[model samples]
Target: MSGPTGILLLDKPQGPTSHDLVGRTRRTLATRKVGHAGTLDPMATGLMILGVGSSTRLLTYLVGLDKEYTATIRLGQSTTTDDAEGEVVTEHDASGVTDAAIAAEVATLTGEIAQVPSTFSAIKVDGRRAYDRARAGEVVELKPRTVTVSAFEVIASRSSGTLLDLDVRVAVSSGTYVRALARDLGAALGVAGHLTALRRTRIGPFDISDAADPEGDLATALIPPAEIAGGLFPTATMDAEAALALAQGKRIPVAVTDAPTVAAIGPDGRLIGLISVRDGVSRVLTNFPNSEEPA
Candidate 1:
């Protein structure tokens, strides 16, 4: 029998890199096809989606979805990495900064924005990872890219010891950099800032609550890959003949609907894979084969 193919929503704990969890998941599921939709830093935790077995095909859709995060930004100190991972390069007394000023700064960061990702980021420069080059004592200046911060709002603000801490909730495009928001906000406010804590609350249709421990039960934690695939795309139910044909790479016809992407569900209501209609013809972007585990 094939191992069940599906998405595993991993509530990644702090301290381990994303790759660490992927390795652990491979062992837990006893499969070598484990992969993640998005990469989270070791210090950050929550809502990381993993693909198992044949479900790896779903990653193409998952990676492009919007993401949401909640973070505690500590004003008055900025690090060389623009996050807690780097050394403190600048500090100031942010106690005097008022709530109104913080609100104004956040307002400026909302909507479509051009942000320079953290220097200590995963961006590839000259075909090498930016963080690698940076750690080698090379100055890496990355070009600013446009990313959408659909919503950027300060949820709460309070005094933490001698510093002002702001808790923020952000809904952004897939590649939006929350660390950059914290860094730029501090710079705009004349007080240094760095992300003290961050948790991914949502990634597309999957919530943090859906995630399970990577080291935990494989059977219970396994999310059917079809669930993740259908959740992100428009759903369509297909008859047995159509399902078999699609599984065999035959095109199916789709009726009118406003959905841009459609999930083709079989007669049993199980997802057959995702399909899109163009000029009344269905095109299969992915055909999920019955998943089985390796010996």
Candidate 2:
């Protein structure tokens, strides 16, 4: 059987890594053309957008969207990776941390602020992943980056002797780290902190509520690229002659104002491709002709 073409929203479970999901999906679909938009840590579980066949081209657009997550922050210990998976570096009594204090610290973290990602992160340092260096027992110093935390609200809190756990929901920009927020919140309260759990609720327009299991036939869950293209950018419907010309990689005289990408629709109402208007001509960014021919 041929490979499935389009996007699949996998409701990723904890334990297995994001790459594991891609490999399994590739085998299940019987195709090698598989890629995921945004990488989730092994401990995280929620919506993961996977692209099958030609839909892999859309991953770039999906990766930069804002994300939402629900997380548990343990406010009594500091971990090497700023999460439960890492070794505890420091332990302290956090029973004194109050709800008012947590809210104040969370407010400081909201909006745009400089955030230093955990050493056990995918960031490249000296041509190597920071996590690799840290894992090898090497000192890793990473610079802080400005990230936007549009929403950071604590839903609940529980105290058990010297330990305190806070449940929070956060909406942040593409590169913002929820683990880092946990770390920072704890630091501000003078009680070391780390993330206990994390579940991504949404990534831009894709939500965990609409996700399917990876163990199932992912081909059946495929969402055509045309279905998503209309939501991402402006659409330009063209005639048969124009669509054919674009399919052949020819530029046509069309005006797409103030938009970097335009969804080109064929006369048959199917997506022709993604295009950019330059010098009064529409140039193809990604082509999707009416034929089901494989690339």
Candidate 3:
């Protein structure tokens, strides 16, 4: 039998990079086909979706899911990296800032807005990562991007001498940056703030509650790809013949609803593949068994 193949929801611990987790999982599972859904900074700890074996093909759909995070923004200082990982660029006394003012400013950033990502970010600038150029002391000018910040609100606040820290929860679209939100919030408040802490609590329907410990045995902890796929999209159960046909890369014409993608399940109870409707024809977007079957 082949090794377990599916998605692994890992509650990634701080300190280890996301790639580090992928490497560990590859070693533990003894497969080099592991891939992660989204990138999480080393300082962030939370749920991460890992695709194993044929399930790696499903990551493109998962990457664009809305995300949730709990973060702390220190309102007295700004950093080069927009987070605690970088050198402090400036400092100011935020003790005079009022709670009412903070709330008003956060409200300004709550809706759809254009935001420039941090220079210390993964976004590419002329084919080079913005972070790499920034770290090399080269100027990196990133254009503003339209991102939806559905919610950006202060949960709590604390003051320590000249500095103020606000505990916040944010719900944002796929490409939104919480660090940039902190930076912009501070800029709006005239106190120059930066992210002091960040933790991802959820990504789409998956939460930390669904994740396995980072140090646990990943192979044994795998969630069947079929199960994960079923939760992500509308499911279409096919009979043995139709399933086999789909698995063999045949387009099985079927009635379509409004779902952009459908999970096609085989009679054997495994995911045959994913399909989409184009011009009223149900076409295979991906064929799972083709990747799973021995080469």
Model 1 stretches astray by more than 4 angstroms:
160-162, 256-260, 291-295
Give the lDDT ranking, best first: 2, 3, 1
Model 1, residue 117: what's the lDDT? 94
TM-score against truth, every candidate: 0.94, 0.95, 0.96
Q: Give lDDT per model, in order.
A: 0.85, 0.89, 0.88
Candidate 2 local lDDT, 249-288, one digit each (tens): 9989885574679988887777789999876688889986
TM-score of 1: 0.94
lDDT of candidate 1 at residue 195, scale 0 to 100 = 95
* lDDT at residue 5 of model 3 (Cα atoms): 78
Question: Which candidate leads the pack in lDDT?
Answer: 2
Q: Which stretches of candidate 2 lie over 4 Å from their true place?
A: 255-258, 278-280, 289-295
Ranking by TM-score: 3, 2, 1
TM-score of 2: 0.95
Please, what are the lDDT tens digits per residue for candidate 1 over residues 167-258? 99999998888889999999999998999899998998789987787777866777765566666777778888989988888876776473
Question: CA shift at 176, candidate 3, in angstroms?
Answer: 0.9
In model 1, the worst 10-residue window by lDDT is 286-295
